[model samples]
Target: MNRFLVLPLALPMVALAAEPAGQATTPLAGSDMAGQLGQLLLGLLLVIGLIFLLAWLLRRVQQLAPRGGQVIKLLASQSLGPRDRLVLVQVGNEQILLGLSAGRITPLHVLKEPVHLADAEPATPEFAQRLMELLGKDQKDKS
Candidate 1:
């Protein structure tokens, strides 16, 4: 009676432990690695996105931060020709007009009374303005 009951319980255990014939009992290692490849790419993209976000935030903060101890501030500017321009700069309480060309800068005059101008965007730098003008001229020539 003990032998009969033991065989019945042991038979099911043996069958459960046995793998089906002519088939893999475990998954391929390459397939497992391939599945993780997607996760790796996603993580890489997330890190790159985080870097870009931080860079953008840094730029924004720099724009909003106070610029202290600036000795000279550009108050006004006007282009004389292509390469020459007049720049008015504030140093302490005095405003001086300066002449800027390709190779040199000259102090033209020192104002007795400081000229006050409205708060506005400073004049675009020379290189950018010249580039745009050149591009515009090319287009005009083509037309």
Candidate 2:
């Protein structure tokens, strides 16, 4: 078993060593501007792909983030008492309560809002659709 494993691994190294010692190891033969530019473009493409992937993942995480008033209510009740200090934030139509106590902080509940999500600047469906389009364009460009 040891010989079988060792032989396979050793064979590649043996084959690599068989190449002439003085031969150059540059990826493409003939040093030219276009080849270097092509390599640079490939590297740039890889970086852009990684950035898009991260943005896509971030959007997914944001989409999956918790919503509704109940979760806020539970957190608030668990983390705050009657005398605790609290900050209420209202964005568009959503409200979040932040509780502050001596050496501790917690979320209290989501307050009722006068405004609704429908009035927000960027609607969820549009944002998701645009994100998908951008990702699709990126994939098409890659191909």
Candidate 3:
């Protein structure tokens, strides 16, 4: 059994030792390596670019779907805890305040009179404008 096992393993080594020494060992040429690397990098970049393009197209397609005709509209939502929230939802003309917990949603209040929201300028400015105003204020204060 020992002889049988040793013969099988040693036969391949004997065959390798008997091969001619003049044969080149390198599988790929030096000049071809750079071209192969460039092709590989280009292929990787193409796959990544295709992924980004698909994501952008999916977002645009989602935005194109009709969104104005929904029956239930979420007016506002405020988080009370990690898993609890207060949500104001408008179903048709009636607005309802809901207390949302982990397990269940309970109706807190129902507004009998709908409050009219005027189309005046927004109460808060845009984030960039607000940041610029704050920085200006800070600079003025320092001076």
TM-score of each predicted structure versus truth: 0.50, 0.31, 0.57
By TM-score, is 2 or 3 better?
3
> Which clashing pairs does model 2 show?
72-109, 76-108
Off by over 4 Å in 3: 1-28, 118-143
Instruction: Report the C-alpha displacement of residue 18, candidate 3, in angstroms.
Output: 12
Range of the 10 consecutive residues with the lowest summed lDDT in candidate 2: 70-79
- Candidate models: Cα lDDT each: 0.87, 0.67, 0.85
lDDT of 3 by residue, 82-140 (tens): 99999888899999999999999999999999755544543345699889989999999
User: In model 3, how large is the Cα lDDT of residue 81?
Assistant: 96
RMSD of each: 10.9, 14.5, 6.7
lDDT of 1 by residue, 17-62 (tens): 6745423545675787887998999999999999999999998998
Instruction: Name the lDDT of candidate 3.
Output: 0.85
**Residue-level lDDT tens digits of model 2 in 1-143:** 89999998999998788775535556445666688989999999999999999999998998887765433222112324666666554654567776778787676776674323443333224577889989999999999
Best of the two (1, 2) by TM-score: 1
- Output the number of the lDDT-best candidate: 1
